[model samples]
Target: MKRGIVFIATLMMLGSCGIFLPRPEFEKGMTERRFLRQNRDAKISNLDNGKTTYRVDRGERFFVLATFEDGKLVKLEERESRPNWMTPQEDPEKRNR
Candidate 1:
């Protein structure tokens, strides 16, 4: 009975630790080449000043954007669409001007 209790306690502790652990997903400073290799179908756009942008369509209603500078990923963004009744049609203010 004591061994079973200890085993259950260890399992519970390990399981809970996963919630606090940092998983490698959508973090900046990742290698752009590796990212492109992983996401082969992603659309890539070349920009000026050694900047490159990648866009991946998650589904019909959402997409992800990542930007790289000097071959290293530097920015990440995500967009999701709302229902037509709640949609907004306006461009956001541009940054990095």
Candidate 2:
């Protein structure tokens, strides 16, 4: 009985310490890559600083960007859809006059 009690106590301590923790369904590295690939269409650009911009095609269309550092997601930025237009440029000579 004493041996059984000790075993149970040890098991409880190990569980609390997460020594026998179950493996996650998707590992961290794989999960991050999968997420990025699955949403590639929404990706507009990526930066070496670990920042990525995604263009979500939701109801009104929007842009979402996120930053990650040290394998951890850190920041997110988003903006609503807006027209992207450029104004006509005058001749350089005219502008110099």
Candidate 3:
């Protein structure tokens, strides 16, 4: 009975690894102004090529990057934040010197 319980618990944990991610409100062709209004605290970067990159940090290792052109959202992607050997931690100030 104990072995069955342990096996069931392990399976449950592994099954939850594929939790679904909700669809984001920002979509293609969304105007920059509208996006800004919806996400007041969004982080945005202006590029020299008239393209903009909007970063969405979910306080996790995974994040989203949205690219805009002609003042409209053109592309969106999910990315993983990996730490490099030079800076093994996410916070640079907290890294081991």
Candidate 4:
């Protein structure tokens, strides 16, 4: 019984530790080329001087806009994609079987 209790306690600690860990959208100082390499299918648009937007659909039509400045990533935001008559959309993660 003691061994089982210890195992359960260890598992709980490990699981709880994960919640406190920092999750960065992209590592600091990540360059534009590096970002493109990591996200090949990501669409890039020039927002302004030394700034750009990377549109990447993670899943379920949830597009993310990663903004970069001076070739370095600066901000991360979620962008909602609206289905329009002329726009194309990506398939969701699950498919009807």
Candidate 5:
């Protein structure tokens, strides 16, 4: 009887895992804007596994960078500027200067 109860409990727990889990979906930087606006509070600064992310700020304006893998935003990194390699490509005026 105890063994049966344990098995049933285990099954119930396993079943619940699927119910509450997040569904996988491909997301892009532009696409995540909606989610970002919706969840302005408790915003998701980073997200992985192909989903949306939000970058929150105290001033209500936040910067975000969506990192893609295979054309999907597998992750999001928040920062003031794009990571690495400051070059003329980033700022055309720099080339003119």
Candidate 6:
């Protein structure tokens, strides 16, 4: 019985892993304005090539880079592999060091 319980618990833990997996947003064809509204506090850098890079502060020591062109989101790259479930309302300095 104990072994059965342990096995079930392990299976449950493994099954829930997908819930924490991060999904990439900011795919091609998304509007820049909409992205900006979603990431309201993101730090933005405008490039000379008419592309803008938005540095998003993801909580728990993570961040993401989103690039836009012609007011449309063109690219999204994460600085590290992590979950995208972090809340934007989190304090940047405290969680992302």
Better of 3 and 5 by TM-score: 3
Residues 1-97 of candidate 3: C-alpha lDDT, one tens digit per residue = 9999999999999888768665468789999888887777678755758998988776758777888899999998988887565465467766755
Evaluate all candidate structures by whole-model CA lDDT and list the values in order: 0.82, 0.58, 0.81, 0.81, 0.54, 0.80
TM-score of 5: 0.28
Candidate 2: stretches off by over 4 Å: 1-31, 50-61, 85-96
Residue 18 accuracy (lDDT) in model 1? 95
lDDT score at residue 17, model 4, on the 0-100 scale: 100
Per-residue lDDT of model 1, residues 1-97, tens digit only: 9999999999999999999986575667889878887788789855767888888888888888899998888989898956687876565554333
Candidate 6, superposed: residue stretches over 4 Å from native: 1-25, 81-97
Task: RMSD for all candidates, in order, please.
Answer: 9.5, 9.6, 14.2, 12.5, 10.2, 15.2
TM-score (all chains, Cα) for each model:
0.57, 0.39, 0.56, 0.52, 0.28, 0.52
Among residues 3 or more apart in sequence or in different chains, the pairs in candidate 3 whose N, CA or C atoms overlap within 3 Å are none
**Candidate 5: Cα lDDT at 11:** 99
Model 1, TM vs. native = 0.57
Q: Which lDDT tens digits does candidate 6 get at residues 6-97?
A: 99999999999989986555668788887877778888855758988989888766788888888888788888645567545767888878
* Tens-digit per-residue lDDT, 1-97, candidate 4: 9999999999999999999996654776788898888889899755777689988897855788888988888888887766566586556754543
Count clashes in each candidate, considering only residues at least 3 apart in sequence or on different chains.
Answer: 0, 0, 0, 0, 0, 0
Q: What is the lDDT of candidate 1?
A: 0.82
Q: Which residue runs does candidate 4 get wrong by more than 4 Å?
A: 1-25, 83-97
Identify the candidate with maximal TM-score.
Answer: 1
Per-residue lDDT over 1-97 for candidate 5, one digit per residue giving the tens place of the 0 to 100 score: 9999999999999998998876443244434444444445645545567643455443433465455444434565555653446543556877688
